[model samples]
Target: MGNALTTICATSDIHSPQYLELFKKALANSTCKPDLFILAGDIVEHNNIAEYRRVLELINSVHPGIPVAAVFGNEEYVGSEKEYVVRYPNVIFLHDNYRVIDTLTGRIVAVGSRGALDKPTQWQAKNMPGLIKYFRDLPDKISSLISQAASTNLPIILVTHYGVTYRNLTGENPAIHPYLASRRMENVIVNHRNVLKAVIHGHAHNGLVESIDIDSVKVYNVALPARGRIIKVEV
Candidate 1:
């Protein structure tokens, strides 16, 4: 019933300290194979497709053919011009999309939804319509999972680049808190909470390291814990 991870690494805002070497060390140094490797968000400081490509190559080198799922933080949004990072294989980028990883232990459903705000200054209340429509549209990234989940007995992991609940926005901007988190997203989560095992989010760097309650399901703020730490979600 808890988000218990036996072996895995989670980090966000990893643009600094150049984590490529450190990530390799963690994978090599560990005795057990990692169940997952997650980059919460802010993987890159600015939108640099070249850097994204390099990061992808470096990660593949460390854990070649390993499945690594990631969500883009606000910093990663670069209009429609950025393509290399979003299109890379091996790296599953969640943009309102979901993926199911059928592991020996259990099945995992990973869905990611993150994009620009119609008007960042307007805040949450005003963005409900657009947000809901976006939700209804889903994304190519997650289309397959919508159907796959019907036939499989897998635990669902809702992954996203934004913080959908206010529970995690503890240290975030008070005036902008409404804008930082998603109200429309909250509605979607609560509706599907029963089937979801947990949710992983990025965006709120200053958010609390706590679990959010989405009806019966527990959502987690998996942003980088300072650095070199991973939160395990064991079902």
Candidate 2:
């Protein structure tokens, strides 16, 4: 990608108040000064929005002013997004949007979203029937965002909360693969491989393969419990 390397430290599924300490410990042990920090999704448990502040506090204590880019997860809930935006104005909350970050090394485009599942979970299907249409349309929306980012002529990083490809969900039950992530999203990344440098995601706590390559684009399942450490990426 860029001549000067850009370092990124990323993780997700903190499920705060439960795994908060685990995330703190992981951050404490990290030695890299990341140009960017990514919270793929599920940073807090349920809709406990207050815990997000604590998570940001921990990150700031170590690397003050480090830009954080994030997407929503199932735990973030639907109605609570505004609370996070109002509470953390400095944070880049990408809900089916893109942000171009200019680091000391080079500029890169980060496209973020809650992502889509091939098949909605039973709970989702039952409670949020409207989501079926949203899920159906998400892949195309994400692709459009990537296409927009490509106009910048910068490498793009796709960050989402759900698994993008089945290859990374190896340990999870095959029957539930459709519920974990969508192959349609994977198709979007493969189609935009020219500028898509990597993909980072969470929500697969049981995923066995932490990282994989799809059409040469690196994909990471950065669930805190799955890897038990922060994932560092250089591009």
Candidate 3:
């Protein structure tokens, strides 16, 4: 109804030199210049802080002063290099956190978390008991952040390393769907659909690149495996 905010979302297991190059090209020549850049998650190959730095530098080169909001994926351990990533000028790490960006158009409230599963899978078993419990209980934690962002009365954009809706994971191996994302998280989005403009996530490499509606809110899979493309959403 008014001038829209353009957001470019890119995600999935980028850590290789080649993938990073592709990512840089995508952002530099985006279909539309982004007002806000959203890095959905799993950005590094193996907790390589240098790779994260490259991604940050590339993003800044593409869109100088634009704010970049990010979340972590299963591959990235929060404390491993999170402190370094946050040190970047305009990068905001939103793993289990929230940030509000005041754009020229209007206020943008972004909430993000690494998110977790509704049940334990093979991957969960590999982690220690404490971590397993933490991942399993992610739905409740992220839901609280959603509620907090909702109270801001600004357009809300959600970023996560895990897919919130099952439909968005289409084409991924069904046998490992439980390990990939959570359905409980989708319920949180459904409940707060009124103010939510878009939900972006990655992690299901085999997932479909689609835009589906949860009420009026759009949930999209921006994983790079299927296509090295950034999704553009107007808020």
Candidate 4:
């Protein structure tokens, strides 16, 4: 295996101008401009599609051609249905689905959902969509994509909007801990441990950028407050 692909990652609770500036600075200072620019979710506070469009426009301005894989967070909830607007060429929103991007070294499979962590216990993933329903029906939807990703036998990078384990749940209220992350996510992810090389998520601002080896698959919390950060994963 050679060195993994490099990319920038950051989580946002709500949209702010400060984030756009930080992204420019990161791009200016970095020796290698990220191949992929990832937004973990909660792009804007209000469900206003206009604001979402504006943010996406700004993001495209900063990193003109880089592919950005993003998911919506709970706060992005506006009235009823989830927002689905794809104007920017680089912006790819992963909701109840995944996308495959072919690369030179190998293929990269990116799976994400806006409200994925609200499922039932780890043991109840099979019923995650029906009876054990909580948040996004990702656990059920991700099965086919994961199977295809693993079938390729390439190093896969899982981009998500929610933390999979409590290791990244530090400095959060104990009362809302369960609400922030669910054990069902850990189960669904661990089931395809062989395919996934790493998992990155947000929604926990004070949480640490930590990694845990679940049956050898590494999960990372990529949220860095309101700033921009970079990460490179090797196959």
Candidate 5:
């Protein structure tokens, strides 16, 4: 028989207090015992930070002690990141950063971020004007992180809140594809295909294509509303 695969259970866009029950049901019904649990982003609704605890509790009840990693989503909002980190010291909140997880199968590097958008949304443009520059600089920051992660010689898994490629954004309006995800981010992933293994992301509620491959790296849109179940990925 082939060697056992390292399983990762991933999901996102819980929008807590809205889809929390659905998320609970999905996790309860899952049969896979994941080596790692990943929350791609938007765990809480409108920065209702307290609800994050409920989500974490549910995960712990189902699979305790597994490494949990997450990136920030737009709903998580700005200015509240440190609070989330302080509250859940256990969760690896990767905001343009990376962490390494050692599993029975092997060690995997997880690079996490809110991701970027090719064009700012109208709301963002009107409010967070500074985001234009931030988004412009994000790909390079993420690329550097991936490059550093590669130095470890471990398979790298990218976890982001925003979609990385338009290929997986089907069912959403093509005209706003730039607002949903970034081709620049896609370029970064493609550039590091030599070491990157898989990419997980959310924020595409209507995304019809849940998974796609860009030149070998697998990309998964794990938004809870889109999948209706927790995604189990074996690596």
Candidate 6:
């Protein structure tokens, strides 16, 4: 067998106190302790500072010393509070950046992007259509980051708030597909399949918890509503 690291716990869209409790209980009851905890996105319902702090505090209280990494969701716009979360001793907030953590298996690198969408669907097509243009370049930026990470020759995990592959949006409305993910980002992951361990994303709460392999790289949709349990992935 290949050198695979076991038990990287990933969860997303934790918006309620109950969901936060779910993580605490899951960790306590887990058969294998997680090497890393990845909060893909939407940790807070509306980017509430208190909620963000509560989640971090809960993780620290329940599973202290575990490395926690996160990316912000659409609900959480760029702000100082987003920066504040990373100040916690054990927290690493990834906003269009990457982090490398050493594990028994080897060096594992995680790259993140809040990511961008293609276009809104008819049902949700309103607001600032013009704004979509502003974020049009995000996919390219993410692609470059992933490429840089791959050059490190480390096992890579891509975490994002937006879906990368369309398969992750399987359970959502077909009309809203464009708005939920980025095809360009998926293309990058597909191109760099050799170094990619797994890709995890949220924002499609009603989406599938299934894993679809793109050239041997596994992509998971770990939104809380889609996968209630903390997803364990061997890197």
Q: Model 4: clashing residue pairs? A: 4-233, 4-234
lDDT per residue, candidate 2, 38-112, as tens digits?
999999998899999999999999989888889999999988888899999988899989999866567888999
Q: Where does candidate 3 have its weakest 10-residue lDDT segment?
A: 1-10
Winner on lDDT (3 vs 4)? 3
Counted clashes in each candidate structure: 9, 0, 0, 2, 0, 0
Candidate 3 regions exceeding 4 Å error are 1-6, 85-89, 119-123
Best by the TM-score measure: 2
Please give the ranking of all candidate structures by lDDT, highest first, separated by commas. Answer: 5, 2, 6, 3, 4, 1
- Residue-by-residue lDDT tens digits, candidate 3, 28-52: 6677577777877778776665677
Ranking by TM-score: 2, 5, 3, 6, 4, 1
Clashes of 6: 0
> What is the Cα-based TM-score of model 2?
0.96
| Every model's TM-score | 0.70, 0.96, 0.89, 0.74, 0.95, 0.85
In model 5, which runs have C-alpha deviations exceeding 4 angstroms? 1-4
Question: Against the correct fold, how does model 6 do in TM-score?
Answer: 0.85
Worst 10 residues of 2 by lDDT: 100-109
For lDDT, candidate 3 versus 6, the one ahead is 6
Candidate 4: 10-residue stretch with minimal lDDT: 78-87
TM-score of model 4 (CA atoms) = 0.74
- Residue pairs in collision within model 1: 3-233, 3-234, 4-233, 4-234, 5-232, 96-112, 96-113, 97-142, 98-142
lDDT of 6 by residue, 1-235 (tens): 1376646778888875547777666656666567787888888776565677787776667667777888888656556544556555456788888988765455688998787777754543466555566457877787778888878877788898888877667789988788888777788787777777898888888886457887889988888777767777778
Query: Candidate 1 has what TM-score?
Result: 0.70
